[model samples]
Target: MLEQVSLFVHSMWELLVSKHSEGLYNSVCLAVLLVLPLLLLLLSVCLCCQGCCGRTCCCSSCRRQQHNRARRKKHDDLWISSQPQPIMMESLTLSV
Candidate 1:
């Protein structure tokens, strides 16, 4: 049984080596080695974008823009309210 298993492994290795010498096998291996990582990177980027966008994939930029606009509006409102009002001359004269 051990001898049979060893022979099977040897035969499989020889077959693989022989196939590697063929251009088709090498091309397939090269494609997998090169394209697989690019495919995975693209997939990861797409998934990350989807997650960042929350419920919608197409509105990530739009949502970010809206958030920025809302934040700016809030800041502007706060700044306007925090400014000191100018004193009228009549009121100042009356107070004195």
Candidate 2:
């Protein structure tokens, strides 16, 4: 009867220890699975950040103002150099 008791106790102890070790291993695996993707995403952002926003020619407000001025100049030149001025048509269209 004592032997049986000892065996039962030993079997229960083994089962508890095995469950504890298995839980620890599973936690480690889950942590790695969750953390690996975040680490990879961070690494990708760090590597590609320069390519996205580093070398655009639109750097300053002054450059933008100059570009807008140039664009307006081109549009004005096309309109002004056309065959008829718009003012003449406006005067002809209305005679109240």
Candidate 3:
């Protein structure tokens, strides 16, 4: 029984081989082989971007907030230093 099944499978393989060079079968096989590697590469790139980019993105946002806070502090200090003295202003007005 198994021998008969084997013979049938051999005949089927031979028929497929004879017809495979005709056109469409060869093209379909070629397309699948070519696209498989490209699909795998794209999947790896997506996973790497998700891992490496996510961590760096968080750190960058944190650093930006710290930088903005420091800039605001510097501006506030300069603004306070430039203001007029209250007693000097009153004495000047009385003198005038």
Candidate 4:
């Protein structure tokens, strides 16, 4: 069954590629011509902005660092809050 399925797929691929090679080639060329300049422009814009942020060349990296710092701070705050308070325990013992 697997062999049959593989053979079927291969035959279909061969039929489409061999029969429509000219049309497929033309469409691929046209798509490349249309998309190449836009891709280049996007890359240029990214390169231009890469150095705009102070102390960091890449914007995404700076943002990631800030996010990580904030997350660590939050985790540290939670850990500190979860620990038992010595002063509160001493006060309770004195009241008792």
Best by TM-score: 3
lDDT of 1 by residue, 1-96 (tens): 999999999997786677677878675886687699999999999999889876664667877888999999977775455668897877765434
Compared to the true structure, candidate 1 yields what TM-score? 0.34
The Cα error of candidate 1 at residue 27, in Å, is 0.7
10 residues in a row with least lDDT, candidate 1: 74-83
Number of residue pairs clashing in candidate 3, backbone atoms closer than 3 angstroms, sequence gap of 3 or more or interchain = 0
Candidate 4 lDDT over residue span 1-96, tens digit each: 999999999997786566567697766766687699999999988877875644564678788989999999977764446667566665565434
How would you encode candidate 2's per-residue C-alpha lDDT over 1-96 as one tens digit per residue?
999999999997786666668898866776687699999999999879877866565769868878899999977774445476456665566558
**CA lDDT of each prediction against the hidden true structure:** 0.80, 0.77, 0.80, 0.76
Instruction: Kindly give the stretch of ten consecutive residues in candidate 2 with the minimal lDDT sum.
Output: 78-87
List runs of model 4 lying over 4 Å from the truth.
1-22, 54-96
Task: Write down the TM-score for model 4.
Answer: 0.34
